[model samples]
Target: MTSPRKVRRVVSLVPSLTEAVAVGAPGLLVGATDWCVHPAGLDVVRIGGTKNPDVAAIAALRPDLVIANEEENRAPDLAALRAAGLDVMVTEVRSLDQAFAELERVLLAGCGLTAPPRWLDDARAAWAAPPSAPYPPRTAVVPVWRRPWMVLGSDTFAGDLLARLGVRNVYADHPERYPRVPVAELRASGADLVVLPDEPYRFTADDGPEAFPGLPAALVDGRFLTWYGPSLAGAPAALRAALRRAGPVPSPRRP
Candidate 1:
């Protein structure tokens, strides 16, 4: 009888999972995708991007386990890895609650941690729902991309995070998880605020705010709004601060 192989060396395809495992187990993560930027100064062999990882390179690393997300990773890649005889752990987190449960599973069951990581407990406490002080009501147009104009539509981790921050996504029932809506339609969607995050599309104060003429734009951190790792501990407070900065700036008085 052979015992199961331990997760000694891990490769994380999801940026959030990378940070979780890297911080929790330290040195267990040997490889990660190029996009795994958290815990800055993370020293590991860069395999490639999430959607298109270097399979050959990853196979060469001989990882005991590879962490990925249902959204960030592609099915074909997971299949190829499995075909190569490597164990792949995929996570799916559409809401705040699911994120917590999945994080615990990834850290303990997937990575073989003896107990729940401290960050998980701290994150749970940080986002313990029902609010300490009720924030003002807000209806927001949360755009994650531009040029093509994509928004946070139904059942997304970002949308759930925003909901907890006292902001309701205008397109929460758009049918598509991330629907491509026309800019003009978005402007007329009766959203009082535009919540833009600096990732998947870097929306700066100048770059994104101008699109919504009169709407207050809350430029929040994408990591805080999207990633479900150690950053979850600081996300609520950071997002609250960003939302407070929401206000429309008049366009330079038209020279």
Candidate 2:
């Protein structure tokens, strides 16, 4: 393992990891994927998208360490970077607790920092317990994409995030992590609410709500629901507010 001083130049392939390292130690990041949009006005070389990063470009930067995530990046891409002799650190964040632990590893252990940033502490405190809601847990379907209609299934970080906010994903028991079910099936799943996010598919009031005529749909910030980084600090409040506005659902409209 290289010393802290030796790990100065870093490249981040994952958006959340990029934001974590950038917020923790901005000067350390030399190159990052185009999708690393957090910490707005970040002035790093664009390496490409998370799925298709410019390996040669990243190699050209000669970074001391390249950060990645198991789900956000492709295995072959990480392998290719390693094949070129670049040190790549991959993180796995399946749950909120895992996210906190991995953030510490990346920023402190990987970035060679003595301690985690204050936002990490703030994030931990923000989601320490489930939010106090007046109504009972609402069954919801969180769609990440529209084409072929993929929804959040069992064991997803987003599912756990919503669960913490008192919203239960109807498909949380599905065998697949992200299952592609037809729109008809999703509408008939008995979900009282549909939580739409503005990412991975960019669902909006005009775009996604019409699918379920009478079901209450909550349009939320995808960053808070999906991204696990400094944003986690405000996620609890933001998500609670969105769910609050969803109010109650009406009877399902007959075809």
Lowest summed-lDDT stretch of 10 residues in model 2?
129-138
What are the per-residue Cα lDDT tens digits for candidate 2 across 142-164? 99999789999998999998888
Q: Each model's RMSD to truth, in Å?
A: 3.8, 2.2
lDDT of 1 by residue, 104-215 (tens): 8888888878778898999999998556322466888999999999999999999998887778899999899999999999999988889999998999988988999888
Candidate 1: worst-modelled 10 consecutive residues by lDDT: 246-255
Q: Please provide TM-scores, in order, for all candidate models, with all chains considered together.
A: 0.93, 0.95
lDDT of each: 0.89, 0.90
- Where model 1 places Cα greater than 4 Å from the true spot, the runs are 1-5, 129-135, 247-255
Which runs of model 2 end up more than 4 angstroms from their true locations? Answer: 1-5, 249-255
Q: CA lDDT of 43 in candidate 1?
A: 97
